[model samples]
Target: MATVIHPTAIVEPGAQLGADCEIMAYAVVTKHCVLGDRVAVHPFAVIGGDPQYLKFDRASATGVTVGAGTVLREHVTINRSIYPGKATAIGENCFFMSGSHAAHDCEVGNHVVLANAALLAGHVGVGDHTFFGGGAAVHQFCRIGESVMVAGHASITRDVPHFTMVAERDDVIGFNAVGLRRRGFARAAIAELKTAFHEVYFTPGNIRDVAAARRAAGAFDSAEAKRFLDFFAGGKRGFARARRAEAEAGE
Candidate 1:
């Protein structure tokens, strides 16, 4: 299929668009941008805009790359990286709702969904199959694990673990059981994840010590459990935890 660019849209010279791309009215695909096959840029969306950094050079040769089958809705803005040869990357089959923003140097993974007005700060790394609720905001340099669900209006300043569901208050409520089910995770795997979740997040001892002990004991039975344990090892901003008061209330 041929690429389609509306007469009203401005695709700057040096932008590389693959087959079947659709650029709608008033959308801008700036120079150095690369859009893969079937990518859609809706009206008023802006791709490959300059980085919003004080130290960024205007002459930098950085760019943005959107993988195949992604959709950027109306009013969405995705900024390019700051340094030469770098890029702000969005993976295949992702969806960015209207008004969503991906700041400079973000690494978004495949099948991720960013709802309307969701914002990702510079250098954020989001894993595959994650869901960001409407108005959710992730702080710079944060890492969000795969299959996680962030509730609407949440402010995420730390790393979120895989298969978790975070509430609006930045608390990890529990595993994303429904998402796991929908994704066809085996029942036994889900059960193992549940047990590991309780041990890592809700154990009585010092959280770090408990996690270490569990790791040392070879207590994790599944690959998913091991992955969960590995996540805590590199938590620079720490991990999101259950709010004790809130959990008590819910119980």
Candidate 2:
């Protein structure tokens, strides 16, 4: 299938668009962008714009790469990276809703969804299959884990572990059990994850230390549980902590 660009849309010289991409009216794909097959840029969306850094060089040769089957809805903005030869990358089949923004050098993974007005700050790393609720905002350099659910308008300033649901300002409320079930995770795997989650979050110790000790002990058998424990290895920002009172309230 051929790529389609509305007459009013601007695909600047040197922009590379793959087959079946549809750039809607007034959308802009700058020369710094490389859009993959079947990517859709809705009306007024902007891709591959310059990084928002104040001290940045305007002549930098950075880029933005949108993976295949991604969709950028109206007014969504994806900025190019600041470092030369680097890119603000979005993985395959991701969706950025209207007014969502991905700042420069973000590494967004496959099947992620950023709801309307959600904002990802520069250098943030998002794992695959995550969902950010509308108006949610993540601080720069935070690493959000896969299959996590961030509630609407939440302010996240730290790393979020896999399979968790966060809400109300950096609170890891509970496991995203419903999401795990929908994703076809085995019941046994889910059970292991739940156990690991309790040990890592509810334990009476430092978050990283608890996770490391549990991982070192070979306590968890399932890969999912290990992955959850392994996420505590290294990060600049601390991991989001579970709010025990809130967690128990729902139980």
Best by lDDT: 2
Model 1, TM vs. native:
0.94
Error of 2 at 198 (Å): 0.3
lDDT of 1 at 106: 98
Judged by whole-model lDDT over C-alpha atoms, candidate 1 comes out at: 0.89
Each model's lDDT comes to: 0.89, 0.95
Over 4 Å off in model 2, which ranges?
248-251
Residue by residue across 1-251, what tens digits does model 1's lDDT show? 68999999999999999999999999999997999999999999999999899999989899999999999999999999997999999999999999999999999999999999999999999989999999999999899998999999999998898888887756887778789889998888888887887778778876667777887899978887777777777757877888655543432
* Candidate 1 residue pairs that clash: none
lDDT of 2 by residue, 181-250 (tens): 9999999999999889889999998999999999999998999999999999979899898888776553
Determine the backbone clash count of candidate 1.
Answer: 0
**Relative to the unseen true structure, what is the C-alpha lDDT of residue 125 in candidate 1, on a scale of 0 to 100?**
93
Q: What is the lDDT, from 0 to 100, of the residue 127 in candidate 1?
A: 86
Give RMSD (Å) of candidate 2 vs. truth.
Answer: 1.0
Error in Å for residue 240 of model 2: 0.9
